[model samples]
Target chain A: MAIHPLRFFDVNCGIGPYYNPPPGHDPSVSALLRGMDELGIAESAVYHFQAQQYDYRVGNETLLRETAEHDRLHPALMVGPGHTGEAHSPDEVAALMRSGGARILKMFFGVQPFVPGPDPFLMAPLLDRVAERRPLLILDHADIHGVRFDWIVDILEGWPGVKVILVLPKLEYHERYFYALWERFDGFFLELAGDQTMGTLEAIVARFGPERVVYGSRYPYFTPLQTMLQVIYSEIDDEAKRKIAGGNVRSLMEDVIL
Target chain B: MNTDSGILRSALAGEPLDDVLVIDVHVHWGRWLTMNLPAAEDGIVRKMRRAGVSKACVNGILNPDVAEGNDQVASAAKRYPDEIIGFAALNPYQPRPMIDELRRCVEELGMRGLKVHQMVSAPAYSPFPIDPLDAAWTQVWEYLDARNMPVLWHGVVEEAVIARFSGIPFVMAHGLSSPATFRALARYPNFHIETASTQNTRWYMAEAVDVLGVDRVLWGTDAPLDDFAHRWGVILDSDLSEDEQRMALGGNAARLLAL
Candidate 1:
């Protein structure tokens, strides 16, 4: 590690063993922290793998327990529309946020069993509650074909107060939807791990200012190295690299009232 | 803005590449795409240079003249022998001519492998989808298998077809097109996976290394179509041991190509 001009604040990462057998890394707290230390990741917003794979409560508890000692590890609780009591009511959601000291809420519509759409009853009220706290809402765009950018537009328009981070938006949709969202909404920020195409990161930083593009690792599932290098070795200036790597995320964290 | 020309490249160059060769296993060539992105060979070469890609395996996608596509790749390979490793595109719809073209490209023109754009082909000609397992495609599969050539195909093909032609090292261009694909092809020793467009994560590469071992994973860009830096970043930034990193970045591709 040559001393670089930037420290990374990974916005999307995970802990615990994944339910999917033999296909994903099961990074323990120590393992995750060690990687962060090695990669120079200053802080990370992490969720438990069980939160997405099994029960949300179990995942949240594990996240709270695992990351409790590490000040750099901020918990991003996996949340869904309160359908099967996986997540109950808006008040209960607020309680979970407050009790756990979680400032980020992550949703997995495509991977987990949940629906995010025009319907108000299924999700709107909970999102409205999340907005009041001003916590960052991270959504997984794991499958580009399945993710509807239009639905994201609805969230941006309807829940104006809630800050949104779209995690892992694939290369296929980056030009069309990622750029569209970046250009249109002030509320949304894109996690940078997914834009592995050449020149995409430098181009985004040049066009939209480094503030809109925050460093994300999609960690445990992915490593911090690729995106970290993408910023460190990018054609963009060091000031922009500094901001994209960690400053922007730190500033965003400062803004959150919680 | 430190505009010291090639500062990043210089920094990376200082890192040890003593035993490693970073060969990108996937890239698309020519301006065949209708939506119009810069798909030129020079653009790809420049991008490869910027990303420090020692070599790239490219598939030449030609329209109505499918045979010319193979020639285009062969020509590119000739022009940039060290940088470009060419793979002929086989249009499954034109099954009969594909075998002959494959022979010409590999045997005569020095192409190292074959590329099948099954996902692109499946949708483009949706009215009649070309199945990889159909008996008509057996001769092509057997030819590649006999020669022990690698096939880089996008999306999943039937595991049985993969099993039958198990002698041919099939580099599933998308991390075996999910875990089930990995489970299916796990039995076949010759099968491998290219770490391109499979999300840029060290953990993902680690997972691939875990399931298939370091030797089976190849780093790829799917470039001109994808970001070369971003694709390479996936391998460069992973948490795998230095040796595993070396293997995924190029050692595996080197063995595949017998370079």
Candidate 2:
């Protein structure tokens, strides 16, 4: 019944206005910070909805400008595979992110049409650039994205240095694929946004240790309290809970070469 | 109440409520067809204890095997009588009369309610999409309607059919995502919704309360399939008042089930 001592540093969150936001949903940076304070989240790595709904370049710029005053809000720029020239070259985008004081690169391969499949020849150049820079890459996967486990394996194999944290993955059915990936890739991490099934969190922490699991709340779209409770009420030890809550993500951001 | 409320504080502190009654209405036992889960009785009860859920209305996942599945629910309820409440699963597509199975489950197996999933398509049970409003389910509906029993329905049921069976308290298992459906069903007193969904937003509970009022909304976790703590935390952190929260958590369900 005692209050948990763990601090939370959310690795996946979005800020700015949504195209068709939920009723009573406030997507502003101030609202996000208020929600974080209420949920006891110490810090957050955030991306702009503009990056997702409109141009990534404009969205990335808007993110930096909006979150410039808030030191607790770390910028996470949305980057594509650079096939349409909208993102320019991978190196340019990487450099832009680094110069903006952003260490997290968010990719919507599932939702973005310009972002191609995980074919080696098509994605290798971007993967290679990502591997070289070593910024924390957050890949948002949903059923509509049509992302397969084999395709993810191919991507991880191609770019081993990139610290990839999979967000919003349907873990109920595809946990076997996730376990296989965790067993194979050391750079693999999981953002606990869509992990709602019972005992899966404990199993992941038990097998891979708590260092590879990071806490995340897909804010503005979803509540952070659910995932926060998932970590706090887990059967794992407080030390492991501490790592998963905030320590793991903080360490990941600190280790980014860019 | 604000974010500094006692319930929110207790939840943020990782402590389950001892003052309020917490009952999870959507739960299952046995293995799922597609994936591995902690669906066994021991694991589920342990999770309930950890989440401070006093009772869970449990049904079986073996939909194809109707008798065996009801038996599993019965066995679990018998073993943990205080902690488990049995809900019978009847495959209307089965050759036997569903009303007979309903009687057997309630009279012999001591089940309090009926659980049906018309959406799932298993080869041995429901090979094709059968309309839940079909004549095959009439007998079962009539039986429950006459007895004033409750039904926990997983798939979509039409508002007309729900109105036809007005005596039966129908609890929509995962709640309605569409506001149109909520508005349409707001007039039906027998129609209730629960807060157990994987595809929910932070505003879902508040929006449901706005449309259906707090009394018509119940709390459920869909446990072992979904985490209890996650769903519980969502409601605790919701914008509902403490009285509204209590009604949604257990007051509504306890009234429906006569607990």
Candidate 3:
């Protein structure tokens, strides 16, 4: 470690069974905690795979029940635009977010079938409601989900209060899209699990400051040590490393209206 | 919760493995057309120092102009002979005979091995879409086989072709995606696999070790395309013993390159 052992809080983690997970990967809550401990991560904002794969209500309920006993595993419920009525109304989602103590909302536009696109007509109600709460909204990168980049721009433009964290862009050749977004939006932050292009972490810190970056493992699919070392060995200062490791996410969480 | 891995301990402590012989086999030089890289050879050396890489086997970024790319690698290797081990790049589709360029790079320019990316063989960045087993590549294979030179190939070459060139130490760059390929090539003693792709899972490297043994699995960062510490940390945190880690880190590459 450096002069101080930075505390790490993973913001992009999926817990529960995943379809065709890696050979030895355990997607259970216990496995997530064990991995965090192995990598010295203190806290995690976890969403259930059931939400992305099946019904969001069942998955959200399961996440709450499973992580209720563990204080370190913060529940991040998956939400959608209530198009099929599978998800409740916007008022109900806000109420559920408060009751469940879920300050983070995860939307999987690419993987989930209900929310096909991030068009304003589809996302406005839920996004508008969540915007009032200003919960941290974690989205898989637009490129990964096959959603157009402008759709994300629209989301950012419409919901300025919602802090969006884009996770898992390809490691190479993502600068043109991501750099432009960083320059345009102060609310946009990057979780550095998938964006490990050479000198990207240092360059991003140098240009955007450490607050615009956060730590994530994309665990089960990848090892946490991969991105952890990226942050630790980066040329940025020790304080920036600390903020990227955990402080940024902590501040984002503390800013939640819930 | 406690662990025995010193490599893991050092990496987690944010300290360089000064005592460990870490050799990154997959590094690139020169400017990439698609992405921004560090300015020059000095940038790579700075990264190596941070990651504690003893040496890197490097090649130039893929371009249609093969000789120009190889010259950049040759120049970088000459500048930092101790830290950089150059691998000559060849574009088989070039009009000039590839063997002559290979000879020039190895004999005249002092490159130790060959780096082949099929992407450069095509006009644009379309990967060598043609079957790699085609008759055109036979001459290249025969030359490397006769000299017992090592090759780091970025695209797919059938297992039969690998067995045919048994004298050459054929290292598959980003070969962890296919477990079947590993099982098929395990019979060939000269076949090796380098870990450097973005598609790798946590168990992929360990699985490679199980299939090909620790000596056949080499640690490669694909640096400048990927990050050094990110790739190094993958192996350091792998389910491998210290001896296995040592072999994957640098010992196997040293044995293959005769370093």
* Model 3 agreement with the true structure over A2-49: per-residue lDDT tens digits: 222989999878888878787767778998888787777899999998
lDDT of 2 by residue, A106-221 (tens): 87665555455445576677777767667787877545237666766776787777788888766786777778888888888888886467988887878889988889887766
Model 2 interface CAPRI class: medium
Candidate 1 lDDT tens digits, B1-259: 1112232233333222323477888887776444234435777776666556788898886444667777787788888888898887776556546688888888898888888766445666555766677665787898988888898877435577787887788888877336566766766888888877665354466566667888898887677656665555566555566666667778889998888
Question: Which regions of candidate 2 deviate over 4 angstroms?
Answer: A1-3, A112-120, B119-135, B198-200
Scoring each candidate complex against the real one, what DockQ results? 0.22, 0.57, 0.54
Candidate 3 Cα deviation (angstroms), residue B41 = 4.0
As a whole number from 0 to 100, the lDDT of residue A95 in candidate 2 is: 79
lDDT of 1 by residue, A1-258 (tens): 444546778998888887543344446888788777665678888998888778778888888998889999999888777756876467777887788788888887665334443233466878877776777888885565676677778888888877888777654444667777877888888787764555566667667887887889876655566677667656677788889888887877767665
TM-score of chain B, candidates 1 onward in order: 0.85, 0.91, 0.90
Total clashes, candidate 1?
10
| Poorly placed runs, candidate 3 (over 4 Å) | A1-4, A112-115, A141-147, B120-136, B198-200
User: Which residue pairs come into collision in candidate 1?
Assistant: A196-B230, A197-B227, A198-B227, A198-B228, A222-B201, A222-B202, A223-B201, A223-B202, A225-B237, A226-B237
TM-score of chain A of each: 0.91, 0.92, 0.92
In model 1, state the lDDT of residue B133.
Answer: 70
RMSD of 1: 5.5
Candidate topping lDDT = 3
DockQ of 1: 0.22
